[model samples]
Target: MSLHGIGLVFLAVLTGTASVLLAVALLRWWDRGPGRRGARLPQGLDGSLKPMVLLFRGQRLVDATPPARALLDRISAPESEWTRLLQWIGPRFPDAIDGLSRIGRAGRFECLGQSGTGSATLRLLVEQIDSDLLRITITDPQAEYAGIVVDSMSQQAMEEELDLLRRSLDQTPMLVWRQDAEERVTWANAAYLRKAEAQADEPIGWPLPRLLDSPRPVPGAGTRTRRASLTQNGAVFWYDCHSHPTGDQTMMFALPADAAVRAERSLREFVQTLTKTFADLPIGLAIFDRQRHLQLFNPALIDLTSLPTGFLTARPTLFDLLDKLRELRMVPEPKDFRSWRQQMSDLESAAATGHHVEEWSLPGGQTYRVTGRPHPDGAVAFLFEDITSEMSLTRRFRAEMTLGHSILDGLGDAVAVFGQDGQVIMSNRPYRELWPGAESLAEALACWQAGAEAGSGVAALGARLTQAETGLRDTGLMAGPQGQLLGWAVTKLGAGRQMVRFRLPDPAAAALADDKAMLASAG
Candidate 1:
């Protein structure tokens, strides 16, 4: 063979070797598709990449990560749940026939039964593929770290945290609890356990029927009652219970003491606030019996009565108060003022009617208004106000009116008074000087309003002065034989009546003569 031919053969062999290596690499990459394509899956049991695994349902652990071991260690059931884990395994691994064929596959593993493997810790794997291949890369928590792995450390940490949490719950003045699927106490921190001991005679693990308010059909371990607590073995606890369904089990918790105490405090505060509001009311308030005796009275009543020594003075009878009022001139003295007889009659009539007794009045120069009503339950309510200034102003106005009438009469001219209804009520004797034939002041008013010597408009003016009022002051003019009488008149007496006055301008000599004649006549 030639040197060039040998070189060509060597090159071909190298090419063939490279091809085989490429095929092997491709096969490995394809088998790990799930792990190579981004972060597609969670970590495996040993925190390695999640390799392709074969699982048999009902025969393996539920979780496939290190955290799962720490978590599952707390579960009460481990082997009993194996049948459930078998459902998670692939179909091919458990269905195979040849054991050798199952054990021959490499890079395909399983979670070999957890057993003592001569060492405390060891990497566990099946190193074979079969009908129920459970490929896994497991590290025995007891072996790899020589019993120093997360099993002990994580458990210690969890227990410490639980202790701290228990202390927190115990510090509160409340009962706290955790219940199992059967409503039996699965866990009870110190506070709840003590209370339970006081109420229930049994310790933990007691049957839920003897411990809780179980439903008739047991509610399948997931039923709960609100505002209710487990009463284990004659023990009673108050709580609001709620059940959380986790697979075939349940969990429950509650806090009762704090809730009830807070509710009671709120109700008491509300009642106290209501009572204070009624007691401190600003309005004068009083309660009287059917016999007219005072039962309850507030500070406002005392201030109104101005009882210098206080109202507790001898429990004065109703008649006694009336007598005192009369003596003080606060009430009309029957001996001095019989005129109030009509007012008393009106009051009786008002009481007989359904009208509540109410009136405006002034006491010792203070004005007030009061109202009284009968209580349906044989009591009475009285409300009053002060109105003194208004009544005083009214009396002053009446006195001034009388004085004005007297001055008008003293004018030596014919003076007259008319009621608001347009009827003449009073007049001086001098009115006859103007019309001697007039019999009464009413007849004189009729003639003057008729204006016998006046034009049509003047008489109409007299009629208009008596027109219904529109609640406003009105003025009108009346013509008479007295030559443009200049009788300024105003309609103020209501219902069309006016205060009409007139006088002829006195001639200088005639006025002097009249003044002297009147004086001489007086003499």
Candidate 2:
């Protein structure tokens, strides 16, 4: 055989061997699949056909599988990839981040998702790749190993319930948020976000800004509440913040309190105005509550009662106030202390049911008109009025009237005064004796006509009594019922009144008149 022929056979054999090796390598690569070859998932998570895996170095995201990347993309948050991933996973596995510390000691740890998260088989796996690197794996063990079978009806119901809850939280007017042990906000509802945005100069991001100041000595077990305020666009908004501890985190809710705050402010202002008005009042006023404790008083009360300001300001009970007044001699002197107490008890009862009035004649010669009135809600009010001057004036006027009446009774002639309405207003003792039953002007005129002669000027006296003119006077002679000579006169008085008088003619004047008549007859 020739040498060239042997070399050609060996070259052909080598080329055939190389081609077989290349074909075997291509077949093995095709069997590995795109998931295993294209994206490098975490070690244990590679078995999943579509694993959601993320790798983080400290707080920065080093890498993520395609599914994890898609999840991060679906979450709309202005935060880094690590924060975005945590936001997605935290609701399902609340302890996901908390368990990371344990991974450093244990190398790897697993946690189950919260119940009612739609899938009971959900799990999260955290592994410490190194001192600074962490690998997080989220999967459904049932779906991966045992095959997941779902009831469509139950799934739809759960989805509907979740949607309703989401809508309710978002549409609520209250601001709700959850905070971690570090007092950093982890989650917030739509309302909270809107408020944060309104107050913030920049766009809101992850770890949402806290709307209310964190309560000191962190709330535990039960709920704690406080009032909080926020200013937006120069307008202040008020809220009642309620915080309730939930597991390792806290759930906080802020309800609108603007209306309540405004109402309280208005009530305070109204009370201030009432206090000012009472201060300037002239009438002494003291108001006691339903419990009989002094609640309100005026400056006039202090001046009139002469009670110590400190004692009044101490809010003394009704009995205490009365006892102090007795000690000060500001009240009427009672027969005894026991009787005074009984009287006060009755006064209180009467005042509560209706009005009560009493005149206190003090030892200091001051008369006080104390009035008690029932106030709303079973309360009683006492008004102390110093009526000393008024009482003195009234007594003096009454004495003057008595003196005037006595002077009229001492007159020698019968005098009667008639009012404008033709009613007999006043009569002296002699006048009453002269006309026994002349109670009015008409009756008096009838008596006079019956006693006097027909041409005795009785008609002229009636006309003068009835006239509206003042300061008119007339006098004449008349024959009495006993045939005796009588002198009569009518004088108009003030206020359309008239005075009528009657007296017997003097004997001396009658004799002189007789002598004159005799002389005239002889001539």
Candidate 3:
């Protein structure tokens, strides 16, 4: 009973083992079979297996293998997948697209990739799959057969980085290009191509056209910049071209400089206008920089200071200019040399913070009004104005006024003059003595009315003095404050001025003066 039961268990175990072995063999075969998904590889140019394969139906992508899909994914273009693939291979195999159209009749075609595209070892095969379908197979014999393995993630990152770099270079606003040692343009970005097209009024092609002219004294080892201009449609555009040497080739970049150039031109024109204005000014103008060195001077400065034009043009310091003036006897003589230096220092300090004015009486009997003003950026401007004629006229007018006042004082009668506004403008010493504290015309009128006897015409006299009309006169007798007889007269002067005079009226004195004249005649 034990042998039979053990035999049955052993047979059951053996059947189970054979079934498991058969299942394992079938699974292995299925996994390694040609019918497995993505296991079929397209034939290469030499009839070897290639991993990269793509099928197209009249410009439409129908199917692609894993490596081909990865390559298409790596390429970035704003075009259909079939067009993108063509673009990716166009540089490597320029005739690949043309060969595909003829593949229907030829059945197959092969092309070797071109150099400079990093695909020289690549081989492309185009074959007719059906009446409307075409197949393309790209193979790199070295990479496919040489056991070269690449991490997919790393390759994807590298492709993205390359795409970003290409986008940045193409979209930048600045024009960029590369030239060989012979100054032949080798490469250019999209911006460069656009500018070249606009300038030429046509499309741009390979071996880019040169935009900026070659600078005088060719660029050397380091970066060099030159200003270049481009005229388009009757307008000039400016650019600052920067060139950098890279090995035997040179890299160039052009930045727009139109705004900067316009600003500089405006500044130059303004300076020229200012120079012309300064040249014609009568007052001597001297402008000093922050360092106190003379930066600008007008012709009047030379004429006024008697300074040599050569010396002023040499840009002398403030102190040096003062020293020259002192030597030429143009400046007022100082008490001592040390005091003069101190005075000069004080002048500079005052002029820097605020305005300073001084009067100089030269030895040649001429007077000058010198004004110093602070300017922006710690600069200073000095103006020298000749005021000799003005001073002389002022002195002459003052002397005439003094002489007139003396003549008025010498009069025996008390005299006071009133303006049209009824304000006392002039008064002699006698008038002041007669009417003490009577300064204005109203006060004088009040004093005369107080002293005058009743019905003495003082009110009438005041009305006459206040009238607007000129060339009128009035005379009368009034009693003084002491009861003494006084004679008064008011005569209108020109420009609405009135002159009033008062005198002591003595008939006895008049008779005495007549008898004395008779006695002297008898003697």
**Per-residue CA lDDT of candidate 3, range 152-172, in tens?**
222434654677888899999
What TM-score does each of the candidates earn? 0.30, 0.61, 0.63
Give residue 38's error in model 3 in angstroms: 24
- Give the poorly placed runs of model 2, Cα more than 4 Å off: 1-157, 214-221, 413-427, 436-458, 465-523
Tens digits of per-residue lDDT for model 1, 1-523: 9999999999999999999999999977876777565533333344543222223332554335444343344445546444322322222234322332455454344443222212223233444334554444334444333233334334444555576776787786544445555556555556656665666556644432233442322455556555655554675556655555555445544556445756877999997785576457644455456665656555655565554334524455444443454555555335444555555445434443444645434345555555555666666655544446667788899999888767766775554545665456655555545545544435654667555454554445445454554543333344654544534344355653445455545668678999999999999
Clashing pairs in 3: none
Tens digits of lDDT, candidate 2, 364-467: 99999999999999788999999999999999999999998899888878888888888889989888987899989989888878987765477777766776
The weakest ten consecutive residues by lDDT in model 3 span 146-155
For every model in order, what is the number of clashing pairs? 39, 0, 0
At residue 462, candidate 2 shows an lDDT of 71
| Top-TM-score structure, candidate number | 3
**Runs in model 1 lying further than 4 Å from the true structure:** 1-284, 291-293, 307-371, 408-446, 449-451, 454-501, 504-523
Candidate 1 vs candidate 2, TM-score winner: 2
- Candidate 3: list runs displaced more than 4 Å: 1-173, 214-221, 467-473, 479-486, 491-496, 503-523
lDDT value for model 1: 0.51
